[model samples]
Target: MPNAIQDQEIAMLRSELEMLMKEREALLRVAGYAAGFIAELDSFDVPRGAMQAAELLAECVNGLTEETLQDALSAVQAHSVA
Candidate 1:
C-alpha cells in the first residue's frame, strides 16, 4: 500500500513537472516574440518599458497554472495590439 501511494505521488509530481515545462515554453515564446518586435522598432519610446515586462514574464513561468497562463497570454496579446 505504501509503495502504491508513493507511485501515485510520483506520477502526480511528474504531471506537475510536465505542466511547468509547458508553461515555461509558452512564456519563453512570449518573450521571444516581444523581443523580436522590439528589435524591429525604429527607436525606444514611452512603451519601450514593455521589454522589461517580457523579461519578468519569462522568469515567472514556473509558478503559473494553465488557466492563469492562458489569461496572461490573452492580456498580452490584447496589449500588444493596442
Candidate 2:
C-alpha cells in the first residue's frame, strides 16, 4: 500500500537525520580540539618571563587573590619549563 511505503520512507529519513546529527556532533568536538591545539601553538612563541608578568597583571586587575595568582604563575612556569 502507499501508506506503508510512505511510513517506510519516513522511517528511513529519520534514521538518516539521526546519523547526520551524530556526525555533526563528532565534527564539532574535533573542531574544538583543533582550535585549542592551535591556540597552544600560538602561545608557544611568547617569552616565558613576559607571559608570567602579563598573567600576574591580569590577575591583579581582575581582583584574583594572591593564592590564585601563585597558582597561575606555577602553571605558566611549568609550561615554560616543558
Candidate 3:
C-alpha cells in the first residue's frame, strides 16, 4: 500500500512537471515575439507617455539569461514560418 501511494505521488508530480514545461514554452514564445517587436521600435516613434512601459518590457526581456533568451527567440522563429 505504501509503495502504491508513492507511485501515485510520483505520477502526479510528473504530470505537473509536464504541464509546467508546456506553460514555459508558451511564455517563451510570447517573450520572443515581444523582444522582436521591441527591437524594431524606433525610440523617436515611441510616445513619451509609453516610454516607461516600453523600457520596463525591454528590461524584463534583457534580464533573461542568454540561453533562455536564445530559446525564447528560437521558439518564435520556429513557429513564424508555419
Candidate 4:
C-alpha cells in the first residue's frame, strides 16, 4: 500500500516537473526577446527614469548561465525577422 502511494506521488511530481519545464521555456523566450531589444536600444535615448530599469534588465540577462544564455539568444534569432 505504501509503495502504491509513493508511486502515485512520484507520477504527480513528474507531471508537475513537465509543466514547469514548459513554463521555463516560455520564460526563456521572453527573456531572449528582452535581451535582444536591450542590445539594440540606445542608452542616450532612454528617459532618465527608465534607464535604471533598462540597465537592470540587461544585468539580469547577463546573469543567466552561459549555456542558457546561448539557448535564449538562439531562440530569439530563430524567431526574429530578417
Q: Which structure among the candidates has the greatest TM-score?
A: 3
lDDT of 1 by residue, 1-82 (tens): 9999999999999999999988866765574454455446554562667767645645566356667656656756765687
> Model 4: residues >4 Å from true position, as ranges?
78-82
Supply candidate 3's per-residue lDDT for 28.
96
Give all candidates' CA lDDT scores.
0.65, 0.58, 0.95, 0.89
RMSD to the true structure for each prediction, in A, is: 9.4, 12.7, 1.1, 2.5
> Of the candidates shown, which would achieve the greatest lDDT relative to the real structure?
3
Tell me the lDDT of candidate 1: 0.65
Model 3, 1-82: lDDT tens digits are 9999999999999999999999999999999998998999999999999999999999999999999999999999988976
In model 3, the Cα lDDT at residue 23 comes to 98
Give the clashing pairs for model 2: none
- TM, every model: 0.54, 0.51, 0.92, 0.80
> Model 1 residue 32 lDDT?
46
Off-target runs (Cα >4 Å) in candidate 3 are none
Ranking by TM-score: 3, 4, 1, 2
In candidate 3, position 70 carries an lDDT of 97
Q: What is the TM-score of candidate 3?
A: 0.92
Instruction: Select the stronger candidate by lDDT from 1 and 4.
Output: 4
